[model samples]
Target: MLFKKLYTKSLFRICPKILSISSLRYATAPSSYAETVDLAYSSYESTEDETSVRPPVVILHGLLGSKNNWNSMSKAIHKSTGRKVISIDARNHGDSKHSSQHTYLHMAQDVIKLLKKLEISKVSLLGHSMGGRTAMVLSLLSSDLVSSLIVVDISPAKTSPQIFSMVNLFDAMAAVSLRSGIAMSKARKLADEQLKAVIPDINLRNFLITNLIQTNTGSYSWRVNIPALKENFQQNIASFPSSLKGLQYCGPTLFIGGSLSDYIGKNDLPEIQEYFPLAQLQFVDGAGHWVHSQKPEKFLEIACSFLKDK
Candidate 1:
């Protein structure tokens, strides 16, 4: 399903003129509004078929997650399907270029560019959390490029209300100060200790600490652009963009929800079907929002099954 280009130019909204500035001073809105960044990616080649012309599966990681998080999963998917798997770090996350704009439009465009760079005309997208939303937008706007989609623990509608509380997590992360020469182990422990007041969940803290890196300067720092992510969280992370209202993707799609997660529910079916008429929904029992991590075997089973079918 190689889709023709839906649009040639990035969508841009003109800023209203400032009354006192001039009669009607206006140029195109700043490029930052829809800027695209070169994403960092890791490719896991298929072991079974070096010459298979099948479309590869592209995994998009979630908020605060990097391609590194999916390394094992990528290898597993490739091993299972004998199809190449490529995972990417979205803008402002992981090793991707940092920018002030972290909206779905900008992110989708980034993926489009990355695909073009790799000469991939069609792909299967597997996304988790924030990445799921990005995949949704890309599929909606460019259906031809998507062969199938697997969304993990999220919906196209508004996200869970609990996501808004992430502001405290970002604040807690921002409050930490790792001095130069801090050991990676000590930095993680110290970060965990400092975050205890705001984030009491040990598992959650450990997951977030995965983003922590020991810099060449011998100092520990977060590679993710926290301030940029924080600025876009309340709106971007909490809900899907309205600008994509009328667009729909007609490709095979699967919505995988964790039974214990509120991120996706029956209430979201209508909204999802509106955009993806062929979409299917499945919930992994006993799994939470981070279903893939919490239940790797089930997640992989379901994902591989879906991939095999469509």
Candidate 2:
């Protein structure tokens, strides 16, 4: 589903108010909050049992996924590590604001703003697919805020076929009309049938179609910017910068890829190391591109181990 627009002009949030380091204010909106706005987001703090003294872990979801997609993983990480977890809906996804521009730099800036607003001095980063790319850019742009980096089943590389497939799914979703009050069950059934040829997995089809929101006028539409994402699909799959020449993140870095997927491979290591010298690569057997969702427990085990430094 080509959800929110990549550059809808609703993504930028200007915070002109400068806060003194001594007076770190939590939950204070920036003075420039009045500028162009679209979706808003809130963090879900871990329960007392899952709370920890370590810096919070920020989780970013992939394309067509909101923070909700990380619910299971977030909860598990929290409980296992007792560290606070903040699952973020990167700009155009979930309940967050949508923007016309979906560039990696723009997406990274969104996370920075959110962290500043939350008064978070430092955070551990975890991202999947598109979110993984966003996290990588964030670490490069604002390395101070990041402690460790965990990438799930995605690399800083071009994904041509995957991009085309995503465009097709978005096209299919845009073509469907459920404005006449179709039941969720019926809508899901129809979505499954429509996407069956392209997305054979019933679970993934349902996951993407969940973005369908029933409007007051009874028309079903997606929360994502359809036109923007479909138009900028190529930009989304663009490679990460390989000229880090001297730049690098020394913190512990984990790269988890799917054995059955082409998202990461030996050929990508040079660039990966060039940017993140301490990065470690691992693979989840039998899993595909969506490694986190396909193998939640294994993903959790690796994540918790890293976060706990055990």
lDDT of each: 0.81, 0.70
For model 1, residues 1-310, the per-residue Cα lDDT tens digits are 1111111122133322122222112112213456688999999984575325678999999988899999999999988887889999999888899998888878888998899998899999999999999898788766788999988889977678888898888888999888889678888889999989998899989888998988787988898899999999887767887656656676778888887889988677777876676677888878889988888888898899888777
Those runs of model 2 whose alpha carbons end farther than 4 Å from true positions after fitting are: 1-52, 157-161, 241-246
Which prediction has the highest TM-score against the true structure? 1
Question: Relative to the unseen true structure, what is the C-alpha lDDT of residue 67 in candidate 2, on a scale of 0 to 100?
Answer: 81
Query: For model 1, what is the error of residue 150's alpha carbon versus the real structure, in angstroms, after optimal superposition?
Result: 0.7
TM-score of each: 0.88, 0.81
Clashing pairs in 1: 3-144
Per-model clash counts, in order, read 1, 15
Residue 249 alpha-carbon offset, candidate 2, angstroms: 2.0
